[model samples]
Target: MKSWSVVTDHREWHQGDLALPSDPRAWYQLGAVGGWQVVVADTPRTVAHDIVTARTTGRAGQTAAWCSLPFAVPVLCTLATGTGVAALQTAVKAASAEGLPLHRAVVALTVIGEGRLPPLVRAAATMLQSQVSAVVTVPFDPHIRAHGLAQAERLGRRTAETGASLATAVLSAAHRAWGDPLPPASVPAAVSAPAHAVV
Candidate 1:
């Protein structure tokens, strides 16, 4: 994501115009007021290992093949497939420790956890969730309570909002005894309690 300028309205979203790059890969760019990097791993062990190495080395972590793109002390965006929120929690701790101020650690736990969604919508779910989460949870640079809800209002297309399509992406385990590839779909509509539930 180049610079998440400020999502003015939903009209801009459907148009995929928000002062951001049109590159679809930009959709995978997730994080805070500044910028962030995606840390995708197949296992929690690997994820934890990578996080640790990054923390100790004071360098951003990347997959064996990926080149770490550190954008101004970027926050970490994690997507792991092996287990629970333990790894995510670790990220939160790391960010907090490093004074990220507004770091995020989200994941699609299990597909079964999120009822179900059609394939295409299911696929779009993660992208939307990441965008929404990062936008809503901004830097304490401003009063969090004051600016939080407004962020959602501006990006939610309804400035161009996609309802159920914006639900959490839950997954069980991809390469497990009882697993699939990733989560089903749907992001958390509300930061705390949602006004309407998504399936």
Candidate 2:
């Protein structure tokens, strides 16, 4: 799988108009802003490894392939399958460890098979549950039947916004998880009070 940029444009709330080259690795062109472009070299590992790993283990991969992207920019994390929830989790963990804060990054996982979407979304929510700012899942597989290219185009378009949103939300959640002042909205609802609770 080779990487290439796909031509596009980014409109940020604060950064104003920006041009994204029609190349996949042009993600960095986003610079230190709230928007960008991400064209992933499709691969099965996205579904095979990331999803299975995250679901099985309580963590994900933090290798070079996953970490090379400019975390500072809103990232469009594309996969051949919508199964890289673990990668996303690993990213959050890495950000926390690096003291970078999750709210500063936006992450989107695109899966080719519509059937696999539900599980992927669930896994992401699981990762984000303990923090504020709900995780967003933009499903485009359903749009494949009518227009396959159209679906891909939509995926590219949504990546910009979702990337920005995820960045902000994750950063917020990361701070809350780490005991900062920011409240984490993504935290799962608490169940069963402590036994030591006063009667």
Candidate 3:
């Protein structure tokens, strides 16, 4: 059996320099937030390296987390666009080489107006389905949060049977994939009531 760990790029708001989450739950929560890209890996070192590299390429103060699951379960690589398909494939290949299972591969699209899953996103999910245990879609549009949340909920329910899931503001796809327990009620809600209902 394999153990899990997490390395996060998030920092608390304070007067001093940045601070990382000392607890795995904190890392999980940060990754669960909307608009952030999440990638899970079988090996901690590789995932950490990838996340660090990815973050360095972007702007500063960009928060992220590298979580290790409780078991040597499947990896859930959550990407944002079509451009990330190649990276997903590479990560899958690497995990296979290391004999680590992949749970799900999710591609989050930040587009408005949704009916069925987009063809390109569908193609990517289909392509990775064989490599991973499942493939999921997260429809997200910051401008229209409610619609995206509704679409995500529908997709999550539709794909639940196949071991796939959706990403929402209240409940993220990463947390669902990781099987992380729900946060305490004392914790503040991430989204409004209408949006929360969708997840």
Candidate 4:
């Protein structure tokens, strides 16, 4: 129901050098300040998996068994363009058969040339809508030197009618999404600190 954004690199994702905000609190604060939910992570898949796993389990893990808990909000997974729609559909169908419970899907519009939101995006959104709670579009570019925000806004507006969340990726060194909003009872009393903790 709320608009959200996730900040990650548009180029290849490296596990150790993620350019994101520093902590979980910072991530929540950014969402609060921007009046939109924000998801920050070391990698896009990690973030997505965190959300999915958190929904299913109170904690995060690398295995499917870790995703046994039920998800509170809709869970979205990235389906970048050029990955072949048929492959995606097949994967989706297989996941469905296995009862993976993926709630939604996202596609990055930054891949399109000339900063244009093509019909393919809308069509994919439409198709995926029936299978998931919503289809979101993220305006991302590794090079956001000029017209980045403007392009994101334009794509967002174009897809507004589909009831999907519109978002853009930003690079921050001090804010990041940690497994907050965890079922209160599930949180441990002395959890380990984040990797980028301030000394």
Candidate 5:
């Protein structure tokens, strides 16, 4: 069975298969009634102009367990947006019109870079990193094409190139932060499981 995410209006933040209370205007605060201390700000990539950061002190699922030289990754999750929700609702309506189940309707959009998936993904990462200082958003390049689907694809791809770009970026960030182990000359040569993509 597929897993569906539940978001409680402006009280919680959730993004998965099927969002509960599929109201397009349902905005979540990213941090909810949990042990997490969420503080929303601007994107992490723009610390030069403005600074938005979030951190987890454990007791929550938002901590980016740092790998030191492998990027200061916090517990990564997808972001949602008004546009993304509208697109999702459009898909849902189409599915409903076709007499398909909610999952069946939503599956078509889950494919990365297809239809509304990218916007939703981008929105999610932006919102997350904006809130938590430790989080980040990987803007995938056309050539690199980071992992957009399942962990199975990220791990089992023969080329092992799915999340290579993101991993490379993380490793580079790690190098910058620690300044050791020299840095990767190439992506394929450097990217590896467990060490590369933290997902």
Candidate 6:
């Protein structure tokens, strides 16, 4: 069985953080508030940039948990644009059609600045909340102005490799933690028993 381990890149940050879940259930519970969820396509790669820069590898699952809440928050980690929004809408429709709980599905969009943010962030944010007082939307913190934005830089680069690695790591860890291996086998009913014991 594969276990989630950390990867590091020393040149990045002095703080070499290990990507572990402080609370996986918390992440999932918070995410469930949203109806359906997707992360920006390549989430691991996005975190990798920082890892590469920092010279460290984190347990892949921990990093993914940190990146976004997939079960609760459908992440759309893409460059903010008109096309991105359209793609997001399609994903939302599909998730909804597939019977994902949409009571409060929040579409999290990644953006570098005021320019690229999809015009629909405002529109999408309120979608669930307005319809069913139970729903709400959350935008990526655009105003969190960092002095030297290394974390922010990598946060936007979602790609297939990163996404797959991160997802595998998380699920692998979850399965291991939950003891999800094949069940035990049963004895044959035809086997004979001791006569004294039967009596």
Q: Candidates' lDDT values, in order?
A: 0.34, 0.46, 0.44, 0.42, 0.31, 0.39
> Least lDDT summed over 10 consecutive residues: which range in candidate 5?
60-69
Question: By TM-score, highest first, what's the ranking?
Answer: 4, 3, 2, 6, 5, 1
Model 5 lDDT per residue over 1-199, tens place: 5333432233212343333332211211222232122222112221111111221222211111111112223222232444544553443344334333222111111132323345555554454333222333333333324432333334434235534544454445445554668433222233355757657
Instruction: Judge candidate 2 at residue 164 and give its lDDT.
Output: 62
Candidate 5 CA-lDDT value: 0.31
Q: Tell me which residue pairs clash in candidate 5.
A: 53-132, 53-133, 54-132, 54-133, 63-75, 64-73, 64-74, 79-124
lDDT of 1 by residue, 93-169 (tens): 55445444222223332222223434543444344344323311111212223353345544433313222222221
- Best candidate, TM-score-wise? 4
Q: Mind sharing the TM-score for model 2?
A: 0.35
TM-scores, all candidates, are 0.26, 0.35, 0.38, 0.40, 0.26, 0.31
Q: lDDT at 118 for candidate 4?
A: 58
lDDT of 3 by residue, 107-147 (tens): 33333444665576568778776665445454433423433
lDDT of 4 by residue, 1-199 (tens): 6545665455432335645543444544444465543343322334333445545676533323323322223233443454434445554565565465444333333343346555665566678667754455544444433444344555444344332433321111111222434322232235487799678
Residue-by-residue lDDT tens digits, candidate 2, 36-129: 2232332223323443465467664322233344332233354424345666666566455544434434455555544545655666666664
Prediction 3 global C-alpha lDDT: 0.44
Regions more than 4 Å wrong, model 2:
1-73, 76-83, 116-121, 129-134, 142-199
Candidate 1 deviant stretches above 4 angstroms: 1-47, 63-83, 99-106, 112-199
**CA lDDT, candidate 6, residue 91:** 50
Query: Which portions of model 5 miss their true places by more than 4 Å?
Result: 1-72, 79-113, 116-160, 180-199
- lDDT (Cα) of model 6: 0.39
Best by lDDT: 2
User: How far out, in Å, is residue 19 in model 2?
Assistant: 17
Q: For model 5, what is the error of residue 172's alpha carbon versus the real structure, in angstroms, after optimal superposition?
A: 1.1
